[model samples]
Target: MALRHFFLILLVVSIWAFNNIAIKWGLLDLPPLMLTTLRFVVVALILVPFTRVNLHQLRYLAVLAFTFGFMHFSLMFISLNNTDAGTAAVIVQLGTPIAMLLAMVILKEKLRLVQLLGIAISLSGVVVLSGSPTIPNWWVLVLMLLSAFGWAISNMIVKKSPPISPLTMTGWLSFLAIPIVGCASWLTESDQITLLVNASWRGWFAILFSAIGSSIVAYSLWYSLLKHYNVNLIMPYSLLTPVLAVIMGVLVLGDSMNGFKVTGSLLVILGTAIAVINLRNLRMHAKLARFRYAGRSKGH
Candidate 1:
């Protein structure tokens, strides 16, 4: 990777990391569901104009919108209401292993033994993190888990869907999410009108940053990188997101970090790195060895 792209990846992850804090800040003034609704409203306003989808794509996009936009963001924001941003960031990493498992079942993808071990380690870390005293309620952890599952489901949907630009998918997803999430907010949340009317600059800033900085800018740059480089080369950099989130949560939000949290975070990060990073390297190396062996056999 060039030095500029490396910096771009850093910038993207940094935006994503700060997004956790932004969500927490938004939740201070706006109701969780309401905050989610407003964020997507902004996203839709900005990106929907550029989106075009055929009738055949509508169903898949709807499912993607529901799973990724509604279920994932709704549950995530609600979970963040009860849990620390850093903890939420770490817990959502479960989506990765969950997506792997889903691929095995739905797409018939095979997992190497190392990947299985990584999943186990990551799960154990979640168990450890759940036992932390800082957790206000265990149910929030369940919500987070469900949120991760939603994200995994969305990933599968994306894999199965027809070729579409990331920005187009995101734009339609956000536009479609408006009604689903907005209705939920209307039905469940009180004081929405008053809250929106009285929301401070921090609340508005949070929504704008999440919609533009995190979703639009970060994902655009990220997809651009993925287009130029192999996925294996790009994915490992994402592991830094939660780590940065944890640091920012501590320093910026003053979120408490104890031994369990620290240990559990390390395990999750390490396991994710092993699952994604090491496995890719192993596959690449194995392929190279096979090619070299074939070359030597031909030479003889």
Candidate 2:
């Protein structure tokens, strides 16, 4: 990748990393469901205007909206209410493995031996992370895990659905999600009117950051990169997001990371790297390592 493209990836990763902290900040002032609902509402207003949807695929789109937009994000924000941002970010990475496994079953997609191992390693890391003593509540992790599963399911749905532009699907997802999530928040959450009326600037900033920065800006940039580069080249960089989130959580939220958290994070990241990072790159790196070793041996 060129230096500029590298920086662009870094920029998007940083924006997404900081998004975790923003969600935590927003949860302090706004109810989790309410905050999530408003985010979709804002995104819907902005992007729905430009998106074209096929009326014939409304059912699939609705399913995508429910699973991806409503269940995934709603559960995520609720999970973040008690869990630290860093932990939530790391745990959510499991969604990749989860999706792979679901594909194996639901879509009859075959998993290579390495892919199966990757899934095992990722799940083991989730176990280790959840077992850590630093976590205030276990249920928070459960909710986050469910959120990951919802995300996985949504991806599977998309895979089975008709071809549609990602941007258009996202706009429709947010547009559809607004009512589903908004009504749920209104029904379950109390004093939402008061919460909205009295919400501080920080809370609003968090919503805008999630909707604009993470969803619109980051996703748009990501699609642009995918357009130019091979997906394998582009995707491996995204693994940095959780690592960056962990660092941001420590610095901004003062969340403590003990040995277990560190170890689990390493396992999760390594396993995901194995799963998603192109095997071609692995072979190239291996060849380079051999060449370097031979040079050192010759010098000796």
The candidate maximizing TM-score is: 1
Listed in order, each prediction's TM-score against the native is 0.93, 0.92
The sequence of per-residue lDDT tens digits that candidate 2 reaches over residues 131-203 is: 7765668788888888999999998988888888877887788888888888889898999889888989879
lDDT of 2 at 93: 85
Model 1, position 193, has a per-residue lDDT of 85
Q: TM-score for candidate 1, please give it.
A: 0.93
| Candidate 1 lDDT tens digits, 1-300 | 468999999999999999999999998999999999999999989988877899878889999889999879999999999989889999898889889999999999998999888888998899899888756788998999999999999999999899888888888999999999999999999999899889898899889999999999999999999998778878889999999999999999999989989988888888877777765566786698699889989999
**Candidate number with greatest lDDT:** 1
lDDT of 1 at 247: 98
> Scored by CA lDDT, what does every candidate get?
0.90, 0.87
What TM-score would candidate 2 get against the native? Answer: 0.92
